[model samples]
Target chain A: MDWNCTLTEERLSDYLEGSLLPGEAAAFSAHASGCVQCTQLVAQVKMLVSRMQQAPPVEEPRHLAGRILDATLGPREREHSGSGMFAWLPSIWQPRFAMGLVTVAASILIIFHASATAGGKTALNPVNMFRAANRQVHLAYAHGAKFVNGLRVVYEIQSRLTSQPETMSEPISEPARAPNAEPRPGQPAQPPASEQRQKSQSIPHSGRRHTHGASELAALSIISREDLTNGAIRSIL
Target chain B: MRRHTRRVYNLCYRFTGNAASSEDLSQEVFLRIYRTLPSYRPEQGAFPTWLTSVTRNLLVDHYRRTRRDRLTDSIEDAMPQLEEKHSPARTPDRLAQASELSAQLQRGLARLSPELREAVILRDLQGLDYAEVQKVLQVPEGTVKSRINRGRIELARVLEEMGLRPA
Candidate 1:
């Protein structure tokens, strides 16, 4: 009666349905004949299966078939249409088309604007270019000369003090001696106090932006100083 | 129009237990079958077996989504049609007993845990081989065997309460 090691439900179901292998079928039949518990279990299982078998088939809904069919077939129809190439064109070229249009419009506007500004000028580099550049260089050198002249005055004052130390302590008490201490020949005379202040205002501040003319003049002044140093060295040689 | 729909509809009805939901679910299953027909490999299994697998899958998904207690058929509002090609001929007494037994079997089947019920349904009711049942249930053959064993024992216990033996 104890059928602990009996055939399983899957095997028994197979047995009932006549789908079991010959060996399994033979073993099951022999076992069922001898074991009361397994026999009874098989009978109950058979009845359960019979009831299920008797139950009518379930009907699927009608529209679901249509819905699924439509889903699968819709793509096929689009693929078969004559405008397939046309449909795909937008997808392929949309981004490139947008970029090309923007580039062409920008290029057209640049060319038109450049021509409008050019007006009737023969070329960008006329004789005027060289003249304007040379003028700027000249102006820078003139300003540099003024600076050197002021430094000469300061140096003269220092040398005069060393040559005559009495002038340093007697500037206020011996103001009469100042008139005789005029600048020597070929040395520029010091400007009046108000005139000197005006000249000082003309000097460029280091941090301020300079005009193109000022920059060219400053470059010329540097070249002139280098030339002077080379002349001095050659004379010594 | 009505008869054909009704027959297939009845199959869905019994399988799902709720006539209304079965109608909807069955429609969905057939639609799936219709769409997936091109992909079905005959070498894998028969069409009916494949259809049943699809139906079972759909029912399982619905059961999980609803989280309804499947072990109790307390909401049984309708019975599946009893007449079928496989229904064995019987005397009135046996027929009454069979009907009662059939209802009890349904209740017992409803009571089974989904795992055991799936194994039993796939192996017994669907008539799938062990290997085929393994594929359908997506479990090892041994696991399929154990679930079927447990499910059968539970069903036998249910039957014993009604004074029925294997007969």
Candidate 2:
């Protein structure tokens, strides 16, 4: 085979696949052997093609054909036509089934997303979740958060009233008190020290010592606006 | 028909990296085929090419419809992840390396626009000849070839970036 000195780059794939003429094959071989760049390119092309070929063939999952038949045919039509006792059911009712399927799938997705984004730990541990969340609200409030943002602010204030202490600290060795447990007579409505201490210890409150500042009051007012009005109405009644 | 299933599956798998999505898409393609079987004209083209066209059209439609929903999933799963335990291989180290390369390639394929990726997959992964790709894509042979060439070069550049491809 008298060989050419060069092979066209565009036809390299065809030449490698043996799609070229015998004479063209002889020419490609000579060029590939003599030219380092062409040789490298051929090798790379072969590797690429081989990798594609090597991709393991994955079959359609078994029962898929049956499922497809069920989808496209009526139940009686499929049943009478196919002998298999387990022939596919009619898909005429599929729109309703599909709706239910979508609902179930959406619920599962919602649940999965919630658990995944929530760090997949101890979702059943309500005490811990509540405790952790209580601390977050406290921290956010400590930073003088401007808004709770949405219709959920009422719930936020309700929850904050339950878990967080009105005052951040407590004198040690006393039992914990609830955050909004009523204040003693003639005193400002700060929670008692022991109650504060117990609640603080129960939830790991890692923020700086609470600053009893004006922004904190403003945040509290914004959060408790509805609750405060109801409380005043109750007092008058 | 059974033999063609794997090819259809691989095409779907390439478009969608996950098994769950692949299964759904493949089933969707078959259902689509069943519905549109009446419109198929034998004289117009061969069956596999027709099937490929059907598959590609469904895949493109799926991409467009679900692109928005996919963004939310990306954001939700945005945290850096470590090795997944999906491989059945006994050699953990080799399996992990293989998976990383495969993942790199999948990512590269995904980075191409749908048109380029479809052309590349049909030509390279599916091993369809240029003319057959022209049939499936309903484009000129030259256009198909150009898209394929551009797609392969870009994919190779990506693979090289990951150090999966040699100089």
Q: Which candidate gets the maximum TM-score versus the true structure? A: 2
What is each candidate's DockQ, to 2 decimals?
0.16, 0.16
What interface RMSD does each of the candidate structures achieve? Answer: 6.4, 4.1
Model 1 C-alpha lDDT per residue in residues B1-167, reported as the tens digit of each score: 34434434444444454545665776677677777889999998876667767777887788786665533534342222332212343224434444544445554565567788777666655556788777777778778777876777776775576445434
Residue-level lDDT of model 2, residues B94-132, one tens digit each, is: 344444545555666766778888887888778788989
Predictions in order: lDDT = 0.58, 0.64
TM score of chain A per candidate = 0.23, 0.26
lDDT of 1 at A218: 48
Query: Candidate 2: where are CA atoms >4 Å away?
Result: A1-42, A74-237, B70-107, B165-167
Candidate 2's docking class is incorrect
Query: Ten residues in a row with the worst lDDT in model 2 chain B?
Result: B75-84
CAPRI verdict (incorrect, acceptable, medium, high) for model 1 = incorrect
lDDT of 2 by residue, A1-237 (tens): 544433446556567567789887877888788888667666765665567556554445565555555665734344334446634445534699879878999997875555445545665366655666676689878545433332245455556654544443343112223333567788668767787667566665322233333346546655676566465445434
DockQ, cand. 1: 0.16
